[model samples]
Every structure is written in C-alpha cells, then in structure tokens.
Target chain A: MSYDFYMPVRVLGGESVVKTQAQRLREFGECCLIVTGGSGAKNSGALQDTQDALHSVGVAFEVFDRIEQNPQTETCRQAGEVARRCGADFLIGIGGGSALDATKAVAVFAANPELSADDIYKMQLSASPLPTVGIGTTAGTGSEVSGVSVLTDTKGVKHSIKGEQVYFKLVLADWRYTASCPYSVTVSTALDAFMHAAEGWLGPKCGEAPTAFAVMCLPILWKELKRMYKTQELPDSEQRKRLYHASLNAGFTLNQCGTLFPHQTGYILTEHYGVPHGRA
Target chain B: MSYDFYMPVRVLGGESVVKTQAQRLREFGECCLIVTGGSGAKNSGALQDTQDALHSVGVAFEVFDRIEQNPQTETCRQAGEVARRCGADFLIGIGGGSALDATKAVAVFAANPELSADDIYKMQLSASPLPTVGIGTTAGTGSEVSGVSVLTDTKGVKHSIKGEQVYFKLVLADWRYTASCPYSVTVSTALDAFMHAAEGWLGPKCGEAPTAFAVMCLPILWKELKRMYKTQELPDSEQRKRLYHASLNAGFTLNQCGTLFPHQTGYILTEHYGVPHGRA
Candidate 1:
C-alpha cells in the first residue's frame, strides 16, 4: 500500500524532439561532448539531429565515437580526458546502452580527472559530474531513464556504477531513432524490454508505481512479441513506435523495481560467450 | 504517439514518512514557514510530525495557520511577507487543496515582494520562488504533485496561477494523515479524486502516461465509490490507504492531462453557491 516516486528526468517525446527542444541544452552550458559508438549513432540519424540541434543553438561540441559494446571503464576514462581537454560543459549520449552508460562514467571522470578508472565504482566523487542528455537509439536498454550504468572493468568483469548522480538531466526520446535497428537487433532488444517488465513485475520491490508501469507496457510488449514469433518479419514504422514506447514504459518499471536474476545472469553470458546482453 | 513527462517532485510515501525522511528538508535550507488552515492540519497530526521533524534536524520554523477555504491571494501575500521578514528558506504546506495552493503562491510572493497579488497570474516573477514541501492531509486536491494553484482574487473571482516554478520541490505523502478525516470530508475528497481521473482520462492530452495512471487509479476509486454508495459507513485505515494511493495516481494523471469542462464548471459552484470543492 506504500510506494515512493522520484523520477527527476525531463523526458520529451515525439518526432524531431531533439531539434525542436534544443534550447533546453543551454541549461547545461555552452560547450558540449557528443558520446557514441561506431556507425549506430550516425546511421540512426540521432547524431546528425543532435549536431544540428547544437549548431542551431550556437553551442560548440566535440565528437567521441570510439565506445564499444559492453563499454569498458578505461575507454570511458579516455573519453573523459578528451572532454576535460576540450572544456566540455555537458555530454550528450546518442546511441544504445553501451554508449549511454559510458557517457555517465565519462561525465564523472571528466569532472574528477584525478579519479582512476576503478575509482568510479568506489561511489565517491569530489566534484559533481557534468550534466548528461540521453537520446536513445535502441528500444531495449531503457538506459535513458535509468541512473544505473553497467560497464566492464580492465579485468573484463561487468560491474555497475549507479546512483542519482548518473541519471540523465534530460532525455529526448524519438522512436524514429530506433527505425534503423535490424530485425535481429529489434527482436533481441524487445525481448530485453519484455524481461525488464517481467522481472520488475515479479520482484519483491514491485509496488504501485512499478505495477502501473508494468501493466501499461506488458500488453504492448506481449502483442509485439507474439507478432514477431508468428511472422518473423520486421516491424513497420507504426509497430516500431509501439515497441519503443513499450520499452520506455518498461524502463520506468526497471528504474523503479530494478531487474532480478535474469539480468544478473545475462551479464555473465554477455562477458564470456559474446551473446548480446538482451539475448543472453 | 507523442508525449512529454516532467514530474520533478520527490515523493516519499508511507506512515511516519515525515519523521523518517526529515533529512531531505535540509536540502532546502535552515528555516521554513509552515502554512496551513487551522484544525485540519492539527487534527491530521501532520503539523506536529512536521514540527518534530524540523526540531530533530535543528531547522527553525514559523507557523502561519491563517489560510482559509478558497484561500485569498492577499492572505497568501501576507504570509509571504511574514516569510520574507523571517528570512525563511522554504515553505512546508500541510492541509487540503486550499492550504497547499496558497503555499505555492506564497513561495512566489515571498521571492518577488515587488509583484502585487494580481501579477502572479501574469506568469512573471523577478526572482526564483522558494522551494516548497507539500504534506497532504486530504486526498482530494492532489496539489502536492500539481503545479497549478487556484486562488481567490481581491474581486472574489477564482483564478489559477501555474507553471513549472510552482511545482513542489518535495512531497511527503503519508496516507495515515487522512485517517483523521470525518466521513463527509472523506467522501467529498474521494469524489473529487474520482473526477480528476475521469476528466483526465477523457481529455485529448490523455497520452500513454496519463492513460496508464488513469487505468491504475480508476478501479480502486470505483470500488470505493461503489462501497460508499451501498454501505453508509466510513472507510477503515486500510481503505483510507487505498483511497489515498488512488488519489495520488489520479493526481499524476491530472498533472499530465489536466481537467476539462466539469472542473471548470465545478469552480463556479464552489465560488458562487458555496459548494465544497470536491462536491462541486
């Protein structure tokens, strides 16, 4: 009968939200760092839109596009060094979970250059992290709404750095960004989103807020998954929009109740067997 | 297919949340002004709990308990003057809709003393409003979560002052506070909560988020309303908790989609015919 709610992220959804709402970026500062992985951001059109928005708002930016799958802490530290050298006032992450997770870590590293790669997990930061804006290109991770960032250490172990500080200051969620996902990626990510909703629904921490989010998303995910299972066809634009919105709802559930055994176990398969995190 | 979500209030729920989460108040500042209507706050035990919490945190406070039903803008202005004179850092509103609504105006007036009461509706403020903490003693108004505040003007017309600036910084939603309500107030407030969900559900702006909230709260409200219709009895503590939670979910819907014709017409009944706001 009791529940707590504290989502502070300002999420703007719709078509061309990034360009239309670009002025919101000025609240962070003048200079910016754009963080992403190879090809995904550029191919999805999120990166171009973000750059255009930054240009339209007259803000300067630097692009760091070397992040890889299961983002490594050292790579994030390197990006942080670049951000510090370039005097970036904020960071905009424009890809899937890996890129967004690395962006959160990079913000911390950029703000506290003295902190080594391992220091982020210690949960102590001498200065506040740079503000972060998340433009999600994948429907699966729901990392845009979550403060938790799962990253790989130098030893190749998947670990999570999580707290209120890592939550995005703003999220520009355009389902069109996910239109570029291939069939396999689309199915895998939708499965991941389903698991997020399912796990959170079953968890002991599931309360009124989480239950509401789960109820809202489960039917949408179930219908899409059923269609995918039966047809083995790529989703149309309208279906893609539904899946993206469902994932966002699942993200809200995950943000509240968190995931259980499957998510924890999935990370192991991702690290050892090279399975996609969602498929794992 | 398009939506925007931006609720920034940190809501802490459950019994005795005020005492348990008092440390959050420190984030606002060293001193506070406690605003309320006379006996409802005292009867609900919210005022005493707030005082104890403030004392425990070594934060000084002043109590301004003069707010009345359909609270006047001038009264809010006078309270703001008191707050300004005392150099209060924040405002804690405890009571139903009127008191909480007044607290929002007081925050603005306290910050911008030069602005007359009429100027609040103009949506201009020279200074940033003081942070507000809302403690709901009644379930109906949902002012704890909403940014809009309805006030009575000098000419006795009802006007609403609203924007992101008026949103509460924190909301302590302890359902037990409603346990002291009499049967009449309880039924009236429950009806108001139900109307909020219904109006928002039917509104054009009822997107996924608001629709989800409406779905979650509607069934609970229906069951309670039906029970009240059949049985001429007051709700027990457990039922009270359910009702309060339903009201909060409805509040989220109202926050997102807002109200429609019935709410606009209800204001007229309350203003001219002396109807209770919820009943109106």
Candidate 2:
C-alpha cells in the first residue's frame, strides 16, 4: 500500500551509452571535472569513452584520479578545490562505489568552497551541489542512482551524507564496462549487489516499489551467485551484463528501502580489517 | 535489457495527504492557479483541502473550472491566459484525466503566450512550461505521473502532446479523494486502470521496470474487477483506497510502456460514438 515513489535520476543503459547520449552532458555546462579511482576507469575503458564523448560534444574537462577505497572526505575536498580552480561547471564520476561516492561529496564541496571537508556531514550549504553524471564501471555500488554517500572522516570513521541533493543527475550504465572485472572483484561485487537486494527485501521499510525492484533483481543475482559458487569461474560476457543490470535494479531497491543490519556491521569490518566492502 | 528509466514526478500518498504535506506547495512560488472540472474537485473535498493548504502556506491562488471531458486545446489556452494575467507562478491540477491533461497543456501555454492553441502539438517553446502539481481525484488517467496529454485539436481530432515537458513536478495522491466516485464512474475508471496495466503487460515495449509495475498492480486490479463483476455494487472505503493505489501502480506501468491498440481505438469511440473512454 506504500505508494511513495520518488527517484529522479535518469538512467540510460546499453553498449557505449555515453557515446550515444553525449548530448545530455552539455545540458549541465560547458566545462567539467572527471573523478575516478587510480585504475578502474582506465581498466574498464570508461575513461576513454567519457573523454571521447566530451571531446565530441566540445566540452572541456579535467581528471581527478586520487579517490581510493572507502573514499576520504579530505580527498574529496581537495578534488572539489581542483574543480573550482579549473572552473569546471559539473562533475563526471567514473568508477565503482568509492569513486562515485567521493564524487558526490566533491560536488558539494565544489559548490560550497566555504565549508570544510567535515562540514559535509553537517548538511549545511549556501548553494546546491554541482550536478553529477555517473558512469559506473563496476556492477555493485548503485551509487550512480542513489543519494547516499559513505565517506571516511578525519577520525577514520565512516559516516554517510544522504539526501535528494546528492543523487546523480544522469547515469550512463554500460554493462560492457563491467566485463573487465577480475574474478575476486567480480565475486565480491556480485555479493554486494545480492546483499543489497536481500537486505532491502527483508527490511521493514520495503514497500511496493522497493519490493518490485527487489523481486526483479534477486532472482537474477541468485542465479549468477549459484553458478559462481559451483564453478569458481568469472562470469561470461552475457552473465556480466545480467549481473551489471541486476546490480542497478538492486540499487533501486536499496535506494528506496535502504540497508539493514549487514550494511551497518559490514562497515566495521571494512574500516578495521582492510576488507573490501562487498566481501566484508 | 531496456534499462532506460526516467520519471521525475515526486508522489506522496496517504489519507489527507494534501493537509499533511501542504508546505511542499510553497516551493513552487508565491502565487498559483488551480485547474479542475466542475464538481469532482469540490465533491472529492480536494478543493477545500487544497485551499486550506495554500492559505496556510501563504501562497496566493485562483481557480479555473471550465475544463470539460476530453479537454480541448482552446480551453487550456484560455486557462493559460487567465494564469498569465493573474501572474500565477505555478499551476495545481485537481480532478480526473480531463482536468489533469488540460493542466499540462495550460502549463505549456502559460509559459509561451505567443504560441496559438494549435501550436502546442508542434512541441515548440522558447521557455520550459511552468511547474505543475497534480492532485488526482479519480483512480484512472495516471496523468499525475505521466507526460502525455491527450487534447482535442482544432479539427476535433484527439492528438496527444507527449514528452518530459508535460510531466508534473509533484503529485499528491490521496485515495480519500476517490471515495466520492459513484458506481458508473467507479466501474469505468477501474476498467481504464485495468486496461493500462493489461496493455503495458502485453506490449512489446514492456521492459523490466514496466513489468515489475505491471506485476505489482495486475493482481490487485484483477481481484477488484472480478468482485465488481459478481457483486455489481460500489466498492467500500477500503476497496476504494486499494483501487486508487492500484491505478497509480498501473499508471507507472502505462507511463513506461505506453498504450497499444485499445487506447488508440478507444479515443475514436470516445470522440465520435459518445462512448465513455474506459468502456470503449
């Protein structure tokens, strides 16, 4: 009976989605900042495609590749300063959860230079955050469509900055980008996507819309997980595409109902034990 | 595989939703216009609640109630002129499909005064349409969340003006508003909602998101539709609420997949044969 559905992100999925829909990026502004982790964007070929699209559309750009695993708030602040100094009008995030999540915080800082890194959690801003375009290279994070950004503070504690303001304005979901994931990373990210769907499905807040997304995604993730469990093999291209899209569906579920016990406890293992977020 | 999802309307649903969420109206601007059919808005008590909410928020307003069944382009143009003269910043649409559909066209005309009534179909505007708030008093149409507006042209031909431009900025869905519908209206509107779900379920364009919405709403609609066939009685308050919500779910489905044969042919019957849209 819960009929409150309100996700505003526009998602376009296909092969070479960025190339086909590059004109959409121009709507944000003439110049941009591209944010990513050290290697995922290059490894997945998303960086090349994003640059090509921007070049074709005649949009000037710069890259900030310092975001790490469990993104640090101070790092995001530095990237924001870079964007402001370069006069970048919008931000393009290309990578997994960490890089994309950092991009959200960077956008807030970029728009509000007066606020320090820690002030992001306080949620006080004189101006709205810069609009973000997310090009997700990994299948697990769902950060492309979600507003929740988990960032490590100066104390090394993980706190989330969440609200409608942080949601990406556009998401170019190309499953081809996920085909490059190594075996362990693939397994871990698949687990993360599965956990997202499972937690939302079991959560008290799961309503009609969230339940529909969960139902649509859980079976897809289950089939892939079962195959991987039996074979100990990396998914084929078709399976990779399915997994990537399933992760997006799971993201929609998680976006609506949010995470439950596992996510809360998983952060602890990630922070202290050097565990990857999904595996933890 | 079709992973394009982009509906931006924010929907809030529950009993007395308007009164509880009245403050949201203030975000649009200082002054507004309310558009509706003659009695549905008043009889449903949505008008009084809307007025009270607007007054409480200190947002000035005016009402235009001349819209009739299968809204005409000329009528909407006139309403837009009224809104322009009054200096209304935004528009609130209350009632069934006709009123809601007219409001969408009125929004376009209000922002583009130089364009004649027939020019709306051409989809040309120097500026974006005014933001719209849709309050549904009927279980059918789903116009609150959709961007397609079916308006009669100068030749009395029913052509649709569609795109993201016509989408409402916000939607307040109170099932209580639908409780006032009599037996015939209840039956017809329910059938219209059923047709939307069924058509989208069967359509070739029905993708994962649309199918999820179709699956969620189909059973609820089927149960009520079957009961109505056997009992031939009006639905109680609880049933009315269920039906109203089911229609919204169906609306989500229709908004994504759109209608096929029935909707195209049904308009002909409605325009020429004087048959009610749903029954046709």
Candidate 3:
C-alpha cells in the first residue's frame, strides 16, 4: 500500500498548558492579532491568559472578535486587513473551529494583501502565510492541529481551504476551557471528535500511524462520552483532558487520512440548518 | 497526553513505483546526484530503473556509489563535494540505510559547503539541506521515510544526525528490491525493524500515533519472522511486500517515539562483535 503522511502543527495541551506554552509565541514576530468568536474566548478566560502571556513577553497585540460560526470569507479578509493595518506579525486563534479556521484565511490575506477572497478559494498566492497559533476552547473540531479552514462565501456556500500552508505554527490547547461550555455544545462537539476517529479508522486512506491515533483516541473519547451522557455534566478534569487530547489525536489522523462522506455531508447541515460546526 | 508529531514524506510503494514516481524528481531541481553503497542498487535493478526514470524526465544526474555500511562522516563529506562539483541540485538515495543516511549528510554539505563534519553533528548549518528522494533496496532501515542519519566518526564511534532537514521529500519503496537480499541479511534487517517497533512501542516518548504504527508493524513482523525462521528461503513476494511496508511503518514509529536501550546497546555489538546492524 502507498500513502502519504504529514502534520507540521506543534501542539501543547493539558490543564494549564496555555499559560505555560504561550511563551512560544515569541517565535513569531513581535506583534500579534488575536482572533476569536463572539464571547467564547473571553468567557473561557483564554483571551485574558493569552493577553497576559503576550504582555509578559512585551509583544504588542490586537483582538479581532467578530468571527461567527461557519466563519465568513469576507470576515476573514476584513480581519486580515486589520492585521495588516496593525502591522501584526502573527496571529493567535482562540475559541472553537470557526475562530481557528478564520485565522488561517486571515493569515493568508495578511501575508498577501493583493489576493482576493476568490484567490484564496482558488488557493492562488505568492507567499507563505504568516505564522499562526491556535488555542482551542472546545473539545472537538481539532482545528488547533489542522491545516484546514472551512469558510462560507457571500452566497452562503461553504468553501474549504486546505494543505500544508494553513498549518498553525503552534497550538496551545487547555482542556479546562471546555468546562464552562453548554451541555449541548459539549456533547455535539465531542461527537464530532468521535466521528473523526471512527470514520478515519475505517477510511480507505487509513495508514498505520493514523490507525494508531484512532485506536488510542476512540477508547478515551468513548469512555468520556459515556460518563458525560450518564451524569449529564462534564467529566472530571482528568477525563476532560483526556477527551481534549483525544480530539487532538483524531485531528492528527484527519491531517493525514482526511475524512470521508460524513464530513462532506456535515458541511451542508452546518451551512444550511445553522447547525454548530462541530454538531454538523 | 500532549506530544508533537510530524512526518512529511510522501511514499509510493508497489513493484514499479520507483519508475512511476520518479517524475516527481523534477519538482526538486534540474540536476540530481544518486547516492548508493556497493552493488545493492545495481543487483536489485533499482538504480537502472531510477536512472531511466530520470532520463525519461530529462533530468541530468550523476552517480556517487562509494558509501559503506555504518556510513562514515568523511565519506559523506566527499560525496557532498562530488554533488557540489557536479552541480547536482537534488539527491536520490538508492540503496540500504548506509547509502540513504549518507545522502542526508551529503545534501547538508552540498547546500552549505562552509560547514564541516563537526558542524553537521552539532547541527550548526547555515541553510537547509537540498530536497531528497529515497529508494529502499533493503527491507530494513525505514530511512526512506525518516530524516535521521547514523554515521560513524573516525573514532569508529557511531553518531546519529537527526532533524527535520533530513526528512525525505519523496520515498519510493518497492519490496521487490529486498528479494535479492541474502537470507542472513534479510533476517537480520527484518529483526532490526522488529526492534524498532518493539522499542518504540515501549519507549517513554511513545504516543498514540507511534503506538498505532507499532501495533500495525509488530504483528506483521512477528508472522514474517516465524515463517523466515521456519524456512531458509525468503517468503513469497507478497509477504516480502508486507514485511517491507511493516519496516516502513516501524520507521515512522521510530521517527516520532524513537528507540530505547536496545538500539543504544545494539551499536556496541555492531561495532565490537562485527555483527550486522540488524542482527546486533
């Protein structure tokens, strides 16, 4: 069997990993653009922690908080313009898949301002994207460790921009952020993580490494899901961490093998029915 | 629960994949240098096929076929000089571990001639190594998909040079090549591959992805080992392919988790007792 595997995104995860790991942001330049959806990053305290980390490192930063579910292509371009205006050297995406996905497109535009939204969808660009950091607040999507961006065009058609170019330079994931998430959001997102592993495990592109990721993740996620469903509350901190890392592992699998029919079909629900990105 | 994983190699397997995939060589550059050790490549017909593929694509290349087992630093430097003198833009490694390992070091020197052997060992290079393509002639050493080079110094002490710079851009693995390997060599190499999986599976650095690779490889290697031990002759071509791919999978595991005490201790047996690399 012949196959290909690659995942360049560096991930640091745990309870307080964001505080400890955010120091790596120094590897990117001096200024930063923090991207997030409505109130997720703020509510989770991830935004404050990230700001503190940047402040401690004496790096300048600006926050762009307009990202919405099923991030819009136009919003990403506007964020890119903000980054360019502020002379932001890098980007930090904090929140769920929408925020993280939007950051990738924003970085691409910030790096090449001449490129249009259509150019981005077409994937025509002259330079590499600015370095980006992803700090996930949700337990699914695994966007923190993926090089894929799902954005909706003005026509409400979802478009995916993928490849190595979109891979985040660093990913800081703290499981505690999901502790405050709503039950429905938590369960749906967790299910999305499950599907990533289950589908990837059975996919035609499955390889030894990806299967290992699946084997390791499926058990942890299943156990946590069972506990959450029975208790109707989030699992303990330890289990929460396990679920979060399991999602990251599944993301790594998807990075190599990619998803099959389910992901493609899920996109339709997300775009039309307004289903949450993870639930769809 | 958090670990970093990355493997950028694109692998193409099958009896004639080398010829089919060599067209990708043009992506690296105009001219190339083919690195090999002894007659392994010629005996397996891999070198001729590689040359024909390059010729068909009209890419100029030169052969530097003087690598020795347990590749030496001096020899690699010499090969690098040959590559630079020939104006080779990229490198094709076509043999067993020694040749593939040497190609990595040679590519390093060819790109930055100012650096010495000491600099390479210290990873004090000025620029990235040239792109590399690996073709395996042995079922052992998954060097085709890894960016690790184990070279011996003048003191006869084995030193390992590893980094992202050494990762092959493309890997062409064909099980048919190992069909020509002698019984002793084949068994030894296969055992070495087994050790890679076993040790990596048990290492402290072991992660989900690496464990998955080990899980897939261990069973295949075990079954093949039982058969090889039972009969003096090589297994059928199909089994050989399985064994070869298993070795590559083990290599992927080692690339992430790395080997432990066994690999460290095996070096001594190879250096002192003159045991073959895999047997030791």
Candidate 4:
C-alpha cells in the first residue's frame, strides 16, 4: 500500500515540443553537445532547429555528427573526447537511440576521463552524474525516456550500462517530428516499441505505479504499431497522439520495470546485421 | 502533452512506514497536527505508533480527534485555527479520506488566515498550500496521492479544492492498517477504485500513461473488489496486494485523467445527504 515512485525525467509531449527545446535545454548547464547521426535530424531540420533553439537560449554547443547505428563504445569515447575538448557541460541526443546512446555514454565519460570504451563495455566504471535530454526523430527505442545506453564493443559484442537510477533529465516527445522518418525506420522503431510495451509488462517485478504504467501504454502501442504498418507515414492525429503517449508510457514502464527477454533478444539485428537498434 | 503531474507527498509502503513517520513529521514541520475520525488509527495504535515514529524523529504534535464522516468544512476550519494557535507546520491525516480531506483543508486554511468555513461554501477563498501526508487506514479516496481536498460546508453543500496540492508531504500506506476499515468502507472505496479505472479508460484526452494505468488497475480491482464484497476482507496476501496496488493505481489514475462525472458526482453524497463521505 505504500511505495515511492518518481520520474525525474520530466516528460513534455506533443507538437509544441519543438518550441520548448531551448527552455528544456536551459535546465542543464550552458555548454552542450549535440549528438547526431546520418541525415535524420538534419533533414527534418530538427538538428538545425535544435541548435537554433539552444542558440536563442544563449547556450554554446558543438556537433559530433559522426554517431552511427548500433553505436559502438568507441564512438562514445570519441564523443566524450569531443565534449571534453569543447567544454560541453550537457548533452542533447537528437536522433534515434544510436545518437542518444552515444550521447549518454559521452556524458558518462565527459565527467570521468579515466573510463574508456572497455570500462563502459563492462559497465565497471563509476562516473559523476551528467544531465541528458532527448528529442527523438523516431518513435521507436523510447530512448528519449529510458536510462539505458546500449553500445557495441570492438569484439562486436553488445553491452549496456544501465544506471537506471540516473535516467534522462527531460524527454520531449513530438510525433510530428517523427512523421518524416523513412518507412523502414518508422517500422523498426514501432516494432521495437511494441516489443518494449508487452515485454515491459511481463518482465519487471515493479510496483503498482509501474504496473499501472504498463497497462496504460500497451494497448495504445499495439494499436498504433498496427496503424504505422498500414499508413507507412504519420498516423492519424488521434493515433499519433496515442502512439506518442504510448512511447512515453512505454519508456516509463521499461525504465521502471526493465525490458523483457524479447526486447533484449531483439537487439540481435543490431549486433549481427548492422540494423538500427529499433529493428525489433 | 503539456500536462503537469506531481505528487510532492512521498510514499512509504508496508510496515516500514512506521519507521519513517518521525522523519516525515519533522520534514512536515516542527509541530504536527493529527486529523482523524472513527478511532481506528487510534485503536490500532497507528496513531500512537506514528506519534512514536515522530517522537523518535523529534516532532511535536496535537490531534483533532473529532473529524466526522464526509469531513465538514466547519471541522476543517476549527482544526485550521487549532493548527494556527499550535503553530503546526505539518498535518498528518490518519484514517480514510474524510480525515485526509479534512486535514487537507485544515492545512490550506491554516496557510491562508483570511479564509473561513463560509468561504468554502462560496468556493471563494484561495488558500496557500501546506504539507500533508496520509496513513490510508482505509484504501479508498486515492486522496493520499492526489491533489484534491473535499469538504462539506455547514449548509450541507459539499465542495472540493482540487489543487490544494499539498495534503501530505509523505503518505504511509500500511496494508496492515487497512485491516481495520469496516466492510462498508472497503466496498465504497474499492468501487471508487473501480470507477477510477473505468473512467480513466474512457476519459477525455487521457494518454497512454493513464490508459495503461487504467488497464493494469482495472482488472485487478474488478476481481479484488468482488472478493472483498464476498468475503468482507482480502482473503490472502495476493488478494491484499492486488487490492492495495489497485487502490494506488486508482489514485494514480485520478492524478492524471481525473474521474468523470460519476466519481465527481459521488462528492454530492456529503452535500445532498447525510451519508458519511466514505459510504457515499
């Protein structure tokens, strides 16, 4: 009958998310790192738009646009070096999980120079907490709201540093921003989200709060994952709203419950096939 | 998407709740105001036990032992003035929602000296927020985690100040304490939980989070409420946990999508008739 449930990742949902990036960014320190990959965020003008938002807020930033799919811990090491060199105090992970995952590790390393790619790979290092926020241009991963940052090692084995107690500081979920994702990427993320919702429900021995969170999120995601498979584009507004919230709830669910085996097992596509992390 | 949700009142579940009472009281204020009715918390030693917790934590206190069914605003104001004279910084609402509701208003009126019992009838006075926490003694109302306070005015008009925002700084929900609520109280509160789940499922503009909250809570409550009705008590630990979690999810649901007319209409029980707030 008694439990403490708190989500430090202040979640802001919907269309106005684009406009609030700057204000959200200001919640962290001024010097920032923008983690991105390929063309998604840049093409949607999301990358530039985010820079503009932070610029208006008077935050200085540097861009490490070399993040890649199934981000390797080495990429994280590089990003951290960039953050250190640029004196960035905070990170804005601006694409899908790859970019965000990269930023998450970079944040870990920005504070602890002694920890290398291998240390993070083994999840054996300790580092001071770093603030992170996300604006996903994709609907899958739910990375914008999760505490996990998955990366690959030089041996091509995948590793994850799960400091769930230290999750994102803010998550801005804008379905509209994700509308422009290619059909395949959208499908990949949607399936990943689908897996996350169901598995999250069955996986964790979570409390009433997180159990309630799963119940709320599952049906909506099941419905939207279907719709996304059909329309191959932005879902209807109602569905968009539904999926968007599902993503947030799913994030909250898995964040609390931890993911189930299917979700964990689903990551094979990334490790073996070079597919996006969301290819569940 | 821009919706705001916070339960500043921290919660500690299980027998451990007794251990936190003192620290919670000190955090609440230097002097504590205990609000309750039906003598259950007192009889069960929950009241004395909590006082012992607070005493160990070095907190001072007083009690309003006369809170009645439905919790009249008159009682609230009286308790408020008592709090004022006592210079209490925090209120501990023991027992069910009546005590919780009355305590909420008591804290409010104590904070805003200009308000009177009549102001509640007109819904005219704005009271400042004060710290509050609850010992659910009964599992109904979801009041422990919600930002609402309901009271009946002298003229038999029931009113609520939703966003009093501070009812308790910490909620101690010990299922063992819920063991003492009467059969009728159990039925009504469980229905209140069911109504919350049903309403949230179909509620206006609710998100995946609340939707998920409804789904997980509803099925468990539907089953548990029936069991409680048939047996007049939770028959086992599993059923007890189910009911306890359901009660919490019910509160979480209200925290997000707020109950529609049916639940809100229940407030009229205190206003239109003499039904105890719990029975109505």
Best by DockQ: 2
Which residue pairs clash within candidate 2?
none
User: For candidate 2 chain A, which ten residues in a row score worst on lDDT?
Assistant: A1-10
Better candidate number, 2 or 3, judged by lDDT = 2
DockQ category of candidate 3: medium
Residue B111 in model 2: lDDT: 95
Error of 3 at B33 (Å): 0.9
Q: Model 4: what is its DockQ?
A: 0.25
Between prediction 1 and prediction 4, the one with superior lDDT is: 1
Task: For each candidate, report what fraction of the true interface contacts it reproduces.
Answer: 0.76, 0.83, 0.59, 0.37
lDDT of 2 by residue, A1-280 (tens): 5667788998889898999999999888999999999699999999999999999999999999999999999999999999999999999999999999999999999999998889999989999999999999888888887879999999999999999899999999999899888888888998999999899889887777878888998999999989988999989988998999899889988988889989989999999998999999
lDDT of each: 0.91, 0.91, 0.85, 0.72
Tens-place lDDT per residue, model 1, A1-87, is 467887778888999999899999977899999999968899999999999999999899999999999999999999999999999
- Steric clash pairs (candidate 1): none
State the TM-score of candidate 2 restricted to chain B.
Answer: 0.98
By DockQ thresholds, what CAPRI class is model 1? medium
Model 1 residue B34 CA deviation in Å: 1.2
Of the pair 2 and 3, which is ahead by DockQ? 2
- The Cα error of candidate 3 at residue B109, in Å, is 0.9
The parts of candidate 3 lying over 4 Å away from their true place are none
What are the per-candidate TM-scores when only chain A is compared? 0.98, 0.99, 0.96, 0.89
Runs with alpha carbons beyond 4 Å of true place in candidate 1: none
The alpha-carbon lDDT assigned to residue A228 of candidate 2 equals: 89
Q: Give the per-residue lDDT of model 3 (tens digit) for A86-135.
A: 99999999998889999999999998899776578987888888899998
